[model samples]
Target chain A: MREFVPPSTRFVDLPDGFAMHRGGTLHGARIAYETLGRLNAARDNVILILTGLSADAHSASHADDPSPGWWEAMLGPGKPIDTNSWYVVCINSLGSCKGSTGPASVNPRTGERYRLDFPSLCIEDIADAAASTVHALGFERLACVIGTSMGGMSALSLLARHPGIARTHINVSGAVHALPFSIAFRSLQREAIRRDPHWNRGHYDAESYPRHGMLTARKLGMITYRSPREWEDRFGRARTERGLRTTDEPFAPDFEVESFLESHAHRFLRGFDPNSYLYLSYCMDQFDLGESCGSTTGEALSRMDLEKALVIGVETDILFPLRQQHDIAAGLSSGGTDVQFLPVDSPQGHDAFLSDPDRFGPPISKFLSVG
Target chain B: MREFVPPSTRFVDLPDGFAMHRGGTLHGARIAYETLGRLNAARDNVILILTGLSADAHSASHADDPSPGWWEAMLGPGKPIDTNSWYVVCINSLGSCKGSTGPASVNPRTGERYRLDFPSLCIEDIADAAASTVHALGFERLACVIGTSMGGMSALSLLARHPGIARTHINVSGAVHALPFSIAFRSLQREAIRRDPHWNRGHYDAESYPRHGMLTARKLGMITYRSPREWEDRFGRARTERGLRTTDEPFAPDFEVESFLESHAHRFLRGFDPNSYLYLSYCMDQFDLGESCGSTTGEALSRMDLEKALVIGVETDILFPLRQQHDIAAGLSSGGTDVQFLPVDSPQGHDAFLSDPDRFGPPISKFLSVG
Candidate 1:
């Protein structure tokens, strides 16, 4: 299992056309992925890593590019999913602004950026694209499928669409269905983008991006990702010395928390495409595997043919609360799947899956290693 | 104490110039207020009603307008601050857009809207204005000062500034100091306004207001004002019929919670001035009674010369958490003030002061009537 690390990135084209779950064909669709370790002779030791809304395919360092990846804490040699044993493939999601065929990608039909012309995406479409990528990699089934946040929803959708495609599923801080509070926030974030006059129907030049709207949306997302307790612990009512205003300046953020959000949101806006962010946010909110599988999570989970499942929830996650993880575990357990429900007690909230990987790693590693 | 109801809208010109806590003047300023019940010849039964960020001079129905006011449930004949027994005067705060002299008011110096040029406001400024209005009405001291949310902050500010102005204080869902989380959200909300192109440095025509930006800010405020439990009870994962999308449509809110926020936020935008909102929100975040006293609520309350006080907090309020109210009560109690802490079991969150007045009224009424 401890074979040579592959190149940092590899592209797999679904050439003839990749059929999207939402009734559209992604012609010349390509999935950009990075692999860790090596596939065994039987090609049955593969685990697919689906990332959160804002993450790319770089889950771990590779031979070609040795810089640490987004999930470097979890996916290194002898780590969780252990690059020493399991061959892990992390794909940039279908509708993301990464190397994937997303809104920023050029449409084959026209020599222009797809933008809104990219078929309306859903969680199922992301799952379908990942599944096709896995298939195209010569794997009949994955040893496990691990996803976080939006990736978790797509993972469930993957399970529902193609039974027995994955031997196990690791869902972290995700829901079977998006909650009302989250939907409301997501709707507002999308509106922020649409309302930006510079968006110009999503056809603005890449240089003159919708920074304000995207920054607002990112700040909103950042707020939801962290808990109130975390904010309090991190930044108390500590105000700046010079204050947000000088003698003649207008009002600005004087609090440290505002500074934190501004820094992170600015970083996010620089990297993300506004239209892709909108599409993916909608995809996450609109995803409901239950709707496709007889109207309930229990009904849908009953159809899931996974051998084992791991559901991890953070106590302080307001976006995807512990209740959602409980539902996932209960549904799988009722369906006779060996489901290990691990509630990570952390103040990090939803982002704990990424930030506090030490707590998440052991449980996830143990879950993935069982047969 | 039962006497005839007074007029609804009374404009008191603070023509000499109202001094701001931050060291500026509102010249030719006016205080718009409404009074209920008769001010006894002694003027001893008068009670002052301070409002949250958005409320007006009208806290309840009066002779000039028969329509039920925002707090009509808690201020009627048999209600908490019973109009039959107490002469109630609710003044629009100094920096509010409601009928008060705010950023929306015309500046006497230049004969233009004050906008950003309005004197930088703080909680004490509002308290001073309210106190001046009381003095103008010929009341040496108020029987009680009952305030909620931002009003509660103003009440505390009033106590800190002029110790014996009110005999009793009732604070509902308010804090002596704004927490970091609330400050962060408020910062983003203001940014939403500033970043909106239509805001045009706060000089946009009233008709072409920053609708989208204000809507975004309002939605953000609405989310924090309620709890996850309330949202679950209200909207769950209920999707609208015809779905969130029809054939060929752009993004729109498909969730009931989104609809709820949209309806209320739209109504809020129509009546509110953007500059006033920015000013008031900053005023709230900058309110720290501790800074004026001695670096703690305990120090501030120790100097408060009130006879009795009641502090009420809703269990689910994220904006002004129960811990804050607990701190206020503890601080006052420690300082030898007769403080009664009432913890309300409510799912309405910070807005419980307005929505769950049934629970709020009894304790408040009982406390106000004591002695």
Candidate 2:
């Protein structure tokens, strides 16, 4: 039950000129984070957990609040990550709405929020941020890195972008390349935000920032996060006398999906920013982990020491299809790395990583512990 | 390939007042329709294709245009239904947005659109509209009645509401009863409409309406009509970068699905009315074709005197799952009816009935033409 009794919080000053992997640069960027459990004497007992699209560093556990962390089930004391034995750290990635330096982060030079003026970023920059964050965390070398979905992507990007961050790296439900379909859906979400009329060309600050866009984004995200069969089985076109409490009346789905959207919207808005959503979704569209490589998948694997990395995929995950994991495993094994390819089955779809760790946790634990 | 060849004009007038299944009365209502194909000399060669959700009788091909109909590939001059042999007819149901007399229809008494004043309609009432429309066409008995999704529902309701219309039936991706989860989703869609400020209590009357509400409804419908796997595999976080013309932008989905939604929305808005969309959605939610005099599945099957029914369900048809089609087949089989269940493999979800008929048409053609 005790997920990571977080050690403490610290602030790190960005270099005088923080140039992006893209073109532009920023100055005086201060990043903040907290650590959990302890780094072993060898300092090899560290597992980095990167947050997803909208989540903060509070992935493990939180103090001053009884509510368990987002990944509470597996990261607790005596649990899989077993903070009692290993040091677990979660970082709020750059360009997020959380207390990190993002669109919401103040620009001391301009004294205004970054907004869209914030330099466009790719996952490589995110990997860089994580690398810098870890280095700032006083770790010389690491044991493993674990991330789910976007976070999984961040982990993969880190491994590809930064060398030797960990001996073994784990990426769950992520792919080496961004598929067109995913990029298309992300485009629609971004379009929804852009079309909000209220978006005011990305200058709409903290006060407004397109509520409709936020709602539409969450609704769209819900489409990707869960399985269609799950939604249909849970809430198909249901019957009602009064129809939609809206004007359409009783003709459409009063199905459970409405509730799912509403609940998801409410839970998300409390902790997210519109600009960050737009920026991150755009970044996802740009993700190409394979772009860093040689001619073939084999070359890509050869580029990375695959035997040291663990690849996890959710059977029902459509976003990052299991085929991609198989590809990764093939690449890793081709590269002469003993890749632990594990696909956990669940009806939860792309969300299985967060929902079911019974299968996901054990291998991660064994891989991290046995060695 | 002569498909739905609608008559110069098709019309049906209610001779007198009609009693309804939901204990209501409609004082002289008329239903309008369009027909494709030609009836045979025996008239028993009649095949009825029921319209789904807010559809009209324009199922197959147009009249003078003579292109293709709603079920274009399945019903043609020499196709499966073989306008050359069996007469294929589709009719607009009562309470629909087609030319039929619905809430939008002008009431003969006051010459005003029915609006909310229209009495609540049961599936039986909708079935009655189909029966009356078909009877007006001078058909004594139908060889078979085929339905997909909501149309399948109407076909079942017609069997119960009217006596001996068709001996053979195909309930494709539909159910006799509305499940609880189905009810819940419909409830949320209706709620979204009701909560929209512009609905103006359903009196939008074409001047203005809650376009946002209708948009939301369509968006939600988009979710149900398709699958997450398709979304993930096709458009997961993909986007089109700005100023992109030739190439399908970097962030946007080059996936076929993005085009699918765009086309779906375009067709939906042009071909359908917002108010009718709302009302029809509500009506479908109320449909429950479970049991009347049947104690068990056997009894329920016994209640249906179907000679043979081809229960076609798409593997990806989430709204009306394959399991439901199996249940229909199971119940019908128990009652001694010759039943065959076919699962159409597709990723299009419920829309497979209309969109991916290449896979659907062949099996259906074989099933009907076997005789």
Candidate 3:
């Protein structure tokens, strides 16, 4: 085991405009990343951590900014993705609002924000940017590449399209492509944001943001991200009686679940940009590792020459059902690749990957420990 | 069996202000209905068909208007709820905008559209208005009461709170109370409509309705109303080679599913009122048959005294899962009522009760024939 060290944030600039999958180009493309621990003298212990739709590069608390990262529970000394043994790097995806070259980023030619001017993005575009960041950091290969949800799809793309970037793969609650169910939900979210007159075709002023549309989109996302069981357990028909009944005040948040969504929506409205949200969510919908690789999702996974792979799925996940993870594992197994699939029983649903680190920590730590 | 006769549209005034469950009142409230076949001399052969949210009194074609209703697949001559035998009365519910006194109706006091000033509504209130319609029509008792989706909740309320209104009950994909999952979805839908600045707090002019917000809400609904399997089979990842791709035009409907939603949304916007939508959707979220019956869901259901019941649930319904229908059956059984719960295996999901009418017709027709 190696000693833990606080991660450092770094930015890598893609000097040339990055070409998008759908015949668009992103100029002055850059990715922000944070790395924990030190790379071994052999440079063989690097782990790339890809983020979901809204996460940044901050995977854990660092020395300068000791505030906990989103994945604070599972990335530290003696923790899964252990800083003690592996040099872990988490990169903010290309089209996100968080410290990345996105719609909010200024265009090189024009002095204004890219806004809708930013080229249309796809999951592979994000994966390509991550690959560039890894190469820029001077790493020949990685010990493993791990991702959850959108990040999981990105990792799959990296494994399928750009092989040998990582030795091992861990996909948590990720799909090979967007299922119709997810596509429908995401389509509605995008519609909600764009329909807001304030969105002004993604050209709204920063001060008077399209918060209402963003808030509604986030609420829809919050509903889909978690399982029905979780909501029932957490806030089943529970209401706060402090205010007049919701019957009288129909517009107010009545149920505890509504309040939960409202709180999350408010937080997201403050943190996320409307244009970046539309772009990234659309990218997620367009992601098809199978299409990127060759023919089918299974065929794509079968083509990956990984040392070992681990796939984690939750039972109650409606967004990315367990069958999707099973498909990935089966595809890899059929191709004679070493793979371990765990269908974890979790009521947390698609969000279990983030909320239930206990179920993930052991399997991840064990996989990293071997070889 | 009686000979089939086309129905006539009729409206009944409540005379005094109709009182709501939550203490709000709708003055000069009237219900619009269409009745088919002849009412037997005993006036006991009536099968009250409660319309779901967004549906009107037009459950079938009549002499005045030969156009098919929303449920055109069923409810014709020799069909389930057959005009050949049963005197079917389909009524537009109290809070709906279809010829009924609703938010769009002119207020007697202010001589303007009721809009938000319309009293807050609930399932029981809808049930109460339904009961009033039954009495006003001079039906000593109903042969059966049938409802689907939101109408299903109203039917449940009628059975549990206003007993003796019907001899038999058919509840399809309805719950005794709003689940947290559904409550969360409805909250987002309401937020989408209200947050639309064009909505102007439900005070928007009739010419320029909040169609965008309503469209988004309906799209969200369209996704939930059908199962993932149906979408995969119907639309898959199919994209048309129309104009430029979705990546080029982010705001446009590129996919077949999006197009389907857009087309349906446009139709709904043309026919429905935004304020009525808010009032009715909120009413659904507030529905709890148990509370109206002075107990828990199970307790309230157990308190019902019915001759018989047929509860239909689709295996793939995420909106109102089979478990909810099973609970309804179990509760009715606990009360010593003759209840037959049919878990119809269909890819249509929640809408299976409407879309898969062949399966429903057999069970429903058989039940009605026996009763």
Enumerate the chain B TM-scores of all models. 0.95, 0.88, 0.95
- C-alpha lDDT values of all predictions: 0.84, 0.68, 0.82
Question: Per-residue lDDT for A100 in model 3?
Answer: 77
lDDT of 2 at A322: 85
Candidate with more favorable, higher DockQ: 1 or 3? 1
Q: Tens digits of per-residue lDDT for model 1 on A170-221?
A: 9999888888888887888898888877788787776666778888899988
The numbered model that scores best in lDDT is: 1
> Which of the predicted structures, 1 or 2, would earn the higher TM-score when compared with the native?
1
Query: How large a fraction of the reference contact set does each model reproduce?
Result: 0.73, 0.30, 0.71
lDDT of 3 by residue, A84-173 (tens): 778989989898877778888888889888889888788888889988888988997888999989999999898787777888899999
Q: Whose TM-score is higher: candidate 1's or candidate 3's?
A: 1
**lDDT tens digits, residues B1-371, model 1?**
01112246678877476778888888889888988887888889999988898888878887679888889898878788888889999988887777778888778899988878898899889988888888888888899998889999998988888888988889999899888878878888899888877888788776668877798889889988998889999888776665555554467777778778888898887777888889989989888888866577777887778888999999999899999999999998888889999999998999987887789888988987778
lDDT of 2 by residue, B1-371 (tens): 01111354367886567776656567668776666666666667778877777566777665564656567777777665667766777777777766666666666778776667677676667787788777877876788888878888888777765646788888878877655444444544565555456666666645566655565556557767776666665655454343242332223333455555655665665456555665666667667665432344356455656778898887876567678788888877877879888888888888887777787776777778776
Reference-based lDDT, residue B222, model 2: 72
Q: Flag the better candidate by DockQ, 1 or 2.
A: 1
Report the lDDT of model 2 for residue A215. Answer: 71
Docking class of 3: medium
Worst 10 residues of 2 chain A by lDDT: A1-10
